[model samples]
Target: MRLIFGLLYTLFFLGCLTTALFVVFHLLRYSLDRKVAVFGTVFFLSVFVILLFTNALIFFTLPLESLFPTFNTL
Candidate 1:
């Protein structure tokens, strides 16, 4: 069902965000060079955001009903 797929996608999206946060936190907390830490965080976050947004865009555009037309039928 569309609703189930939507829920799963939401969970996946949240998981990605949470994973990014942990990565950023570790980069900032464990790195020896402050400049490298900051740069790495910025670059990673930028790419991650762009990719995540693109993923969401593509996901929203998928024809779920057409893909799962028989899901609701007996």
Candidate 2:
């Protein structure tokens, strides 16, 4: 169960990164104005990175052992 959640979390992060890449691609590829594209890319990336970092910090600090405690079995 513990390993399951960890794998899911990693998959979620990768999914977010993949989605962000598409967004960035569109922003750069379809924009009429170069300055707008550049600014949007910078702002979007900055916020995305900050949120991703903060989420990782919080998730790692969670008391997973207590949340998903293991037990001895016969």
Candidate 3:
């Protein structure tokens, strides 16, 4: 059970990273102004990365027992 959850978490994190990369790629490829494109991509990616990390931290730190005590029986 723990292994499955770990695998799922890893996959989720990788998926987010892949999505951020795709967004950056599209921004750089489609934008007309080179400077603006680079700046936008960097700013967006940085904010995204920060938010992702914060979410992961919260997920891991959260006390699940308080929210779902029944799961402890399983």
Candidate 4:
């Protein structure tokens, strides 16, 4: 069904995006602080959740009609 596909896509994309953000944050935090890194960890997790939620909301509302126009015609 359309609803299931939409949900699955949204969840998959959100997970990837969140993981990417977390990895980048981890790298940056390590560079900035070699010791006492819990603050960075907490910040990374909080931001990840917020951004993931926001991205999911946007993806869920996106119109399916807007996809594929940029593909090269073969």
The most accurate candidate by TM-score is 1
In order of TM-score, best first, we have: 1, 2, 3, 4
Better of 2 and 4 by lDDT: 2
lDDT of 4 at 39: 59
Which 10 successive residues of model 1 have the least lDDT summed? 65-74
lDDT string for model 4 (9-38, tens) is: 867987787787777676666665654466
Ranking by lDDT: 1, 2, 3, 4
Listed per candidate, the RMSD to the true structure in angstroms reads 1.2, 2.4, 1.9, 6.5
Candidate 3 local accuracy as lDDT?
0.85
lDDT of each: 0.95, 0.88, 0.85, 0.68
Per-residue accuracy of model 2 over 1-74 as CA lDDT, tens digit each: 55767798899999999999999999999999999999999999999999999998888787877766772121
Query: For model 3, how does the per-residue alpha-carbon lDDT over 33-58 read when each residue is reduced to its tens digit?
Result: 99999999989988998999998898
Candidate 4 minimal-lDDT segment of 10 residues: 65-74
Model 1: per-residue lDDT, tens digit, 2-49?
Answer: 788999999999999999999999999999999999999999999999
Compare candidates 1 and 3 on lDDT and give the better one.
1
Error of 2 at 12 (Å): 0.5
Candidates 2 and 4 compared by TM-score, better number:
2
For candidate 3, which ten residues in a row score worst on lDDT? 1-10
